[model samples]
Target chain A: MDEEAAKKLIVETLQKKKGKSKFYLKDFYKMLPDEKPRTVKNLVNKMVGEETLEYWSSGSTTLIGLKGVGKQAGAEDEED
Target chain B: MVEFRHKTPLIDQLETGPWTSFVSDIKREHESRMENPKGIDFQFNQDCCDDLLGVLELSYEHGRTHWKHGGIVGVFGYGGGVIGRYCDQPEMFPGVAHFHTMRVNQPMGHFYSTKYLEQIMDLWERRGSGLTNMHGATGDIIFLGTSTPQLEEVFYELTHNIKQDLGGSGSNLRTPSDCMGQSMCEFACYDTQEICYQLTMEYQDELHRPAFPYKFKFKFDGCPNCCVASIARSDISFIGTWRDDIRIDQEAVKAYVGGELKPNAGAHAGRDWGPFDIQKEVIGLCPTQCMSWDGSKLEINTPECTRCMHCINVMPRALRIGLDTGCSLLLGAKSPILDGAQMATLVVPFIKVEPPYDEIKETVIEPIWDWWMEEGKNRERLGELIKRQGMQKVLEVTGFKAIPQMIQEPRSNPYVFWKEDEVPGGFKRDINEFRKYHQR
Candidate 1:
């Protein structure tokens, strides 16, 4: 898949998850079988740079979530 | 009854302007004695005359309060206390001007037994100024105003009891200081007391001898809580740190959040809890920024943490440090030694050598001596040397490999590699996972 198709898939996946805070970039790669790890990383960086996603890491696992998705997903709703 | 005579010319010259007002008050008090029949012992001793000349000579060049050039004069007080002064007028303080300077013998932690303290105090009363500065700026006890003739005799008596010479001053390895380590503090990752003692014992020859390009100071702290502020102060700083992840106590953390106990509040309170859930609270509370969680189990970010024991201090039951962990060596962190004061640079990434720190001695200490001996200028510190030599030369001499973690950010260096296999150890998945993939 090309960059455009990859971007389309990410946007669709994000829309499908709706108010979900986190999603695996690897799952997006699985959807785009021919795309490389570098391509997926670059796309994720672009999305995060655009402030659409927030990326945090633990050990060797990167957790990518929507920037304000936590607000929408009610993760911090109890505290607020 | 004895008559007292004041040297009118000297007093007039010395007591000019505002000083004359104070002199008038003193004259009024001594007026009755001045009229008495017999002559008081007002003759100056030859030694005092010589000291007076020396004081006059120094004062002529540098105004009295110039401590760098002015010599210290101490007067003995009645109750074993000595009044010390870096004076412009040594003649004014007569008894103290005649007293010899005494050097206080300080241990690694500046610790002394009750007997030792009393013995030193007694010696101060007998041979030198009856006062003691627990430790001077160079970290030695300074008993000011001793005669050159009495110096040897005083030293002989002091050492005969303590069996150690006065510590180095004026271009030598000054006394080493260590923070209260295992004896008192909880944050000590390494035995600071032992390291101080070990360095003192191991370098006793160097400590007493003025051999270095300039004075060198070594200070140790058990952890980055830095009770001694060694990193910013010493020529060489040994700060206790660990390579392992900080241990966490989820249960105690739960209790703290549930209000079962108050968190440690005073000096050692590690980190601030900023309104996060108890289970996820560990991440924010660690000094190293090492603690983290993924809605399951808590994890520690070892590389980022300085092992300040903040998390451990906070959740004592949950967080405990690992064993046999050595310290990280930070170089050139002198507080304005040369260039504007700089925090010590992390020199040796991290090494695992403990109390009998022979490996550290060989790797860290020996290299420092060789570097300073060969290249350092007068009064220049190790950090200044590194600043002069540049980090590349320092790494070249010390044999430390350049890594991404070496500099906070990637600089234009051909040696640093970003590829997986190019890294010293094969880059693990965790390295990739935490890449801050969101960088702009």
Candidate 2:
């Protein structure tokens, strides 16, 4: 799929999900045909930097969400 | 051929026996093992035994041979590794064994009970070295080494039916309080044990999970005596404080002055002479020289008083503390990590919250994780991170309002000032003068 088409599919999938925090580049890539994992990771990092999305977890199963999705996770919350 | 260094007479004098020989052998082996042989030196430390066990366990686990010596030895691995130290006198420690170490539970402090302690002791006595340090530094109990197969069984039994947990090790919440509180102490203002147990129960998952870049410690003291030294050590320290007037007894003071009562010895001995005599004594002890006495009235120069509370505790009956009080939340205090020694600072003025209050948990824990998760680098302690980043950032992220008690960088600021004219001196007769007046 083309870049524009992939972006559209990603946005649609994010909107459909009950938890926006669950959306990730991999999810977007999985929905699109012929998308590289690296591309997905880069796009996600870019979004996080732009404050459009939040990224947590250093591992492959990273938790992503809108900048302010649920109540602010406290200092204690970050323990998990 | 390896050249064997004969054991010294000092080594023989020390009844550690083969352990010292083992260390010598390791040193000799290492000399040959490495192309460049470094001289073997023996240094002793009380805490080294546990570290030595950890090293030995990791070495054996990795299929590496460890040379026994009189001292502790261990290697560092990326995530987890063993440390081992040898003690000279095993008979002094009958229930322990050689080649023992602890398994690091990444974030939280987890451990089994006294029974587990006994079992581990039994295993150590049986298969490995006859010595162990139960839940010492890393908050995990040190199991003296056993056969590789015994390790699995031991780990399983210890982990099974675990009661108390291994507290935080790497960048996570540490084990909660393990101290007596108001239930035992006359000075305790809150139920510290309850709070500690509550937190432990409520946040078990958080305690065990290793998500943060560094580890965190929470410690609670029932009162200012701070048996745990929570203020200086823990990332989140909860100390009990009263906001009420101190209870003073004039009769008790008079009796104390008559040498009827004496304070306990050691650091606090000189200051004891309660209910009222202690306050009278404070006239001389006040650092700011704010306390004064007339023939009939005792006055406190509030502005000059540093609120150290020495007078109040010294004469509990003669002087009562105020009831309209709250705890002063301090921050940024920690042990030396990236920097030198640091002190826990008064960050929040008296927070007017009820005791047994979960607000402490809500307020302190939330902000701690937020900042640590965002700003902390691996192995950097919470206090170090806060110091590097600044308290403003912590306040912003934690959403805690700043107060006068939150005196940032107190050492840099001048002491609280009082005008010289305000102090009343020499108005009242001294104890000797009073005697003379009575005689007259």
Q: For this target, which candidate reaches the highest lDDT against the unseen true structure? A: 1
Model 2 TM-score (B-chain only): 0.62
> Every model's Cα RMSD, please?
26.8, 17.5
Candidate 2 ranges with C-alpha deviation above 4 Å: A1-80, B1-100, B103-120, B123-130, B134-152, B159-162, B265-281, B288-309, B312-326, B352-357, B408-440
List ranges where model 1 is wrong by over 4 Å: A1-80, B1-88, B96-102, B265-282, B285-290, B293-298, B303-308, B412-440
**Which candidate wins on DockQ?**
2
Q: Cα lDDT for residue B18, model 2? A: 41
**lDDT by residue (tens digit), candidate 1, B1-440:** 42233244443345577544533433442442234233433222322323333444455556553221211121111001121223334345343344433445477667778987777756654454344456676566876554434555666776687665566543446678887788877667777888788878887655543345556778888876677787787877888877766666667666666666565533333676444354444566554565666555567766676666666765666677775567778777665644688778777756764668888888777777776655676557777887787766667667776655556556654443355665776766564556767443
User: TM-score of each candidate?
Assistant: 0.60, 0.56
Q: What fraction of the native interface does candidate 2 get right in terms of contacts?
A: 0.00
Provide the lowest-lDDT 10-residue window in model 2 chain A: A71-80
| Model 2 chain B poorest 10 in a row by lDDT | B71-80
Candidate 1: RMSD to truth: 26.8
Task: Report the interface RMSD that candidate 2 achieves against the true structure, in angstroms.
Answer: 16.6
